[model samples]
Target chain A: MAGGGNLVVTVSPHIKSPETTGSIMRLVLLGLLPATLWACVLFGISGIAVIAISVITALFCEVTWHNLRDGKGTGRTWFALVSSLVVPIGVSAAGLGRAAPAAAIALMSAFILSEAGISRQGERRHSFDGSAAVTGLLLALVLPPLVPWWIPFVGAFIAIWLGKEIFGGLGYNVFNPALVARAILVLSWPAHLTAGWFRSLGIDATSKATPLMLAKTGAAADLTAYYAPLLLNNPGGCIGEVSAFLLLVGGAMLLWKRVITWEIPVTYLGAMAVASVLMGVDPVFHLLAGGAVLGAVFMATDYVTSPVSSRGKIVFGIMCGAITMLLRVYSKAPEGVTSAILFMNMVTPLIDRSTMPRPFGVVRAGRGVRK
Target chain B: MRVRLIDLTRGLVQENPLLRLMIGLCSALAVSVKVENTIFMGLAVIFVLTLSNIVISAIRPVTPDNIRIPIFLVVVSSFVTIVDLVLKAYFPEVYARLGVWIPLIVVNCIILGRAEAFAYRNGILASTLDGLGMGAGYTLVLIVMGIVRELLGTGSITMMGVTLISLGTGFQAPTFMITFPGAFLTFGLIMGALNKAQSALAERAARRATGSAGRPTPVGGV
Candidate 1:
């Protein structure tokens, strides 16, 4: 069972299995579920709302851009996209109920056009194909739980459009779309993105900095007591930063399923740990604070953006961790997981090119395998 | 004096210096954060460009080909200095905001490019019009970018020390739009939208052409 993609042809030594992009993406969603569920449980209704808006917007953007780019008879669909985008920019906290109808109509029409088979001759239906879903969910996971409704909507648009589609969609995207969106959001509306951190089970929200931020204050002797709460419960950061334990569990599941390799996660965390010691910060605190675990496990190991060869993956991870530590120690920004991962994403191509393994039976430059 | 309309109109859209020709972008991007800065910058560029074009065209007959680039620089820089002095004297606020970009206009590709490409071969009248048109095109794009960036970046458009448009007190403008990367994003999106529109127009024209030819098209059978 080589999955549903039976007709795919490769260069040579085609190893076929029951794995498609959909299946891998499915595995990724499962991997992320633990942290996401924990985040939702911690943040409550606001967290669920943020996730819903982001995922729906992500789907809307994916479907809208896909149909506009590839679908036939797309005049009406084009109108739908413009109206949906224009209408939502006005969606404030007091006006969510008003924007709901417009969003619903636009989404429903797009869903019908894509799924209900208004197929025009040779035009094939575009699948939702969990890739966009993963990006949306990952974007939600990285967002602060107490964000305004429009923040996730805008983030998802940026993720799908500027981050992914503009780079020629999916595997062709150079950076992880979720991280790209998060970085831009952090830059665009720093006040909105940085503030509004919620606590678990409806405790005090807003103005509470993440553990990474607190570490910047240098409570050198008082840090150890916070590790237990930071590990299992939420302190104050992005939604997914709630439980390092659950995120690690999900990461381990992915590792066991071979969805993600050990090189990136292991090297990324290890490098951060070692570098933290070098920088005179507590290594365990560095490892556990902010998005280090989530970023190392999920963001850095993105298949499209990460390097291919084993050596390249190691280089990528080590550099990511090093950059994260450097930014955390010296930079004005509290955490640097997003920036570090994006920086490594930009460097991934160079790493892949440098570390590409030679063909079988080929010794050095002078020796020939065929001869 | 041969005055061709194409010489004046072409730069407006068909060959916008910033968007289509992709020249004079350094100053364009750098000074495009606010609407007022763009207006003054556009004026400075237009004044220098027109005068430089006229001078370069007038000197073309006597100016030797080998030394013409140096000659162009001299003429362009002379005009740029005039603009710099005038802005410094009259519009100190805009000048202070524009800062180094005003002086940097001496090396602006639009002015030098018009001198070398159009004015050197054309008459003064044509060169003058070309310069104005190109400058207008540059101004148009700069203003559009300025308005977009300023409106989104600051949540309002303030011109001439007066508030023109405000998004309201609740609006938290994205500070990113005023940053360096935002200029690039605005430029790219504008260009992309223009490209998409042009492609759509071309496609429709092709479809119309086929339909008018009365051939039994593929769609006709379907």
Candidate 2:
């Protein structure tokens, strides 16, 4: 070594935490599983299909982007990319029934080859960690379960490539990748994204407006009837957002595990409750509806996008709640959680800068410590 | 003549008005939604730009330094007015689609920027070439953007009621590609791609300069 091992010239924050990104991501995934399983149970095979497609596509994009960026073995990378995509496209174009089987085989083979490639001594890590999976699952959770097979595939691409990778990959992204994908999907295909909800498990399980949508037009569901449904199942909203009780349970698990701090979620829900009441609406219903619980417990507390300071987290959470309520009450859109978290994500840097804690024993430069 | 050719070709790539110079973007963003609109808009800009450059260059000696901006504006406005009137009279449909932008071209920074930077001191020939080159570069970007936005946003490209290419009925076009944010996104992506290509070209040139052995062991190439 140039300066010997003792004189290690490394970057700042000399101490290190035991938690690797992989470990933390694993915990995060574990936390999200309850709500995700509930979502699958509620939305059925179509829901599981959406989740699988999104996760697979997300993992694909993550690896593909990394390989392309590395600039070595680019020919092989391009071949892999084209071959994986062409098989499906070609299959469809040749009047073969469904491209799904071809796509699955091609993608699985690509993943296996990539896994072997990364297992070598010095290859890029590329989706070895579970962050991409978490993003994919989060995006799937936000999407309505009944969208065409292609929707989640496209969304996973957007979430990974546009939302995360384009912003210098995971840690530097300003917004939650899942939320960005969901919001863009909504904006791009309102007819599909808005109307694909599978609500209230029964005869007419799909195509009905969400309770929040109906409430916007002044036909509030019976409070007691909705209370149990919204908490347990079949609140007729986004896939993972159907069971507020399950989401809450997951949120509590994450909090208890100390994976996420209480500042953002607590303040967010508290503020939402207060604001909803002020606006003459039921806070409990508002909290259960749309993406409120999912966003507060998961999206807003994102380690990279959210503020570092506890005070900043509180401020961010309150602003998110206030904006969520304001958008729900005033804006044309029935759901506000996605936009609220996204908007606050943009403001996170300012919150962090302003909320920096003063160093111990330090006084203002203009004033003396004695004074 | 060689220098003059360089001046003529430079703006078409290296010193492109919209991408490189980054001047006159508002009009481009506004009018680059349809392939036909871009064509008409591009033509109008080239006409106004070249004539204004010629006029400004011709009058450069007489024009006072104290109020050069105002002089440039007057010269630019006269040319823009001609375009405005001509388009409104002949291509009324394009004029309507490009509404406020035609008038807005008078205030476009590219004209004044070139007048101040290049045309104010250059010969009429050089200024004329620069103007044409810059205008062509701008139009190229506009056409590319129009094709991209229209093709993606609508699943097809149509120019003057003639369909060029359609992605068929199954294609679910993302409407985001047609919106204002889409304009910024497209512009950014194009710029990023150009940067990537330019860097690659520079790297190849460096490799050639280093020697035909092609090992590229010079500096950090290894």
Candidate 3:
């Protein structure tokens, strides 16, 4: 397995594993499936449409970039295209009740045409695997369903371009691409991103404030009503963030598969719970509201952006939760999960540096040298 | 004469103050939200820079080197006061928008930098040309940035109370483009584009000089 890598001559007792980047990414995608599908089911056609556009656009960008650069496409690129195209259409048609299927078909067709136009200049094949699709899916899940169609298109492009590629792609990215895109979009159009929230299940399809917003305004009197529907996945919030239960389920799948460890998420939620209690709010309600669960499970534990050492990861999570609560309680913005996670992403390297373990049998010299 | 012309033209691109030399950015970024304000600011800079350059160059031969900086400050402040009074009297709207940035021009690094770096060593004519060139370059960038910020931030471009272009009712403008961070983003992106374009031109020249079938680098590789 290590044969393909640059072999650095080191001390003996070498170990190797068959796990590759593509394999890990596929598992991550599998873990995300439940929450994504639930979001589509609750938000209906528009939710699916957003996810479809994002995923296809992401894959299209990756493949087009490679094709233009290398003049050939890889096997994984074709697989990514087919999967990004087929999965969203199938999920939307099956889950979305009584909405026109034509919209999905038209979107997919247009995307295909775009992909064809992009790849026509090259004769070579490229590989996309599932990383871009995962980023696209995650980005869609965090966005409000009431946003205009073009928002996702623009967001996905920026996510892939600025968030991922500009940092030299995949393992090199400092921030989670989806969160970066969301942050940029939110900053660019606060009215569109933060104001327009659709009720879940398309039940009135009317725009309403998320529970976090209500909490911020102190308008949510019935705290029980706010916490009751957390499991039902029918609340006023971003498409996937509404369902705390489903997000937990997906997170558990990742934990069970060992795609992600429990350190970051556990510490993150624990710290958030403590902060909520300290702030005189119900801990469980705080845990369930906004994007706390989604961000704790998905964004904070990102392999590239999160701290590598276990101790560092715990500190990172605690800081993220604390900053998130501080912003929620004291800042003007109603929610702070995205910004909090991004802030932590920036500090992960510093955390890792501080927490690095000392080498065996090594000792430091005395405090000061003689002048 | 050709060397002097190069000195005059170099500031336009080869050594642009804001984008390349990176001086006088405090006023440039702050007052670039409106085209009218930027024009006034640019003209003020040109006036102050040119006059200060001429004064510094004329005094360099007679004055002691130790007190040159204080002398430069006095000359620059005198010219800045003139600009201040003129704008306050004639273009109060632009002056009002510009506010403290106009007075802060006395401390603007470009004016003093030209005095200390170029004017103190060169003749009066050459120093004046250098100041005009640098000021023109700064003004060009200000106008370009003003157009971008105003057009995107407010969906319309207005100059002296006249609407030059309006995106109309259907367009949704991003207000971030006129904010402080937006100014940095605009400057950074334009600078990056200029760097890339210049490097591409250099590579093409290198290829021409080589006169061989060298492997061609792809466009926009960076």
- Predicted candidate 2 versus true structure: per-residue lDDT over A1-371, tens digit per residue: 77666767878898999988888888888888998888888788878888888887788778778878886557866776677666666667778735664475457456635654654568554446788889999998998888877778789888998899987887999889999898888878989898887855663322487878877987665644566677878557788777888888888988988999999999999999999999998888888888888999988999999999999999999999999999999999998999999999999999999999889988866787663
Q: What is the C-alpha lDDT of each candidate?
A: 0.85, 0.84, 0.81
Best by TM-score: 2
RMSD of each: 5.1, 3.7, 6.2
| Model 1 misplacement above 4 A | A1-15, A71-125, A201-207, A219-221, A360-371, B1-3, B64-66, B209-222
How much TM-score does chain B earn in each model? Answer: 0.94, 0.93, 0.94
B1-222, model 1: which lDDT tens digit per residue?
A: 767899999889878999889999999889999999999999989899988899888988899989999999999999888888988999888889999999999999999898889999999999999999999999999999999999999999998879999998878888889998899999988887777677667667777878855533232100
Q: Give the DockQ (2 decimals) of all models.
A: 0.67, 0.71, 0.54
C-alpha lDDT of residue B177 in model 2: 84
Instruction: Return the lDDT, model 3, position B165.
Output: 97
Instruction: Evaluate residue B52 in candidate 1 and report its C-alpha lDDT on the 0 to 100 scale.
Output: 89
Best by DockQ: 2
**Distance from true position, residue A89, model 1, in Å?**
7.3
| Candidate of highest lDDT | 1
* Pairs that collide, model 2: none
Error of 3 at B65 (Å): 3.9
lDDT of 1 by residue, A89-129 (tens): 54533467556534644564566456536466765566767
Give all TM-scores, in the order shown.
0.87, 0.91, 0.84
Arrange candidates by lDDT, descending: 1, 2, 3
- Better model by lDDT, 1 or 2? 1
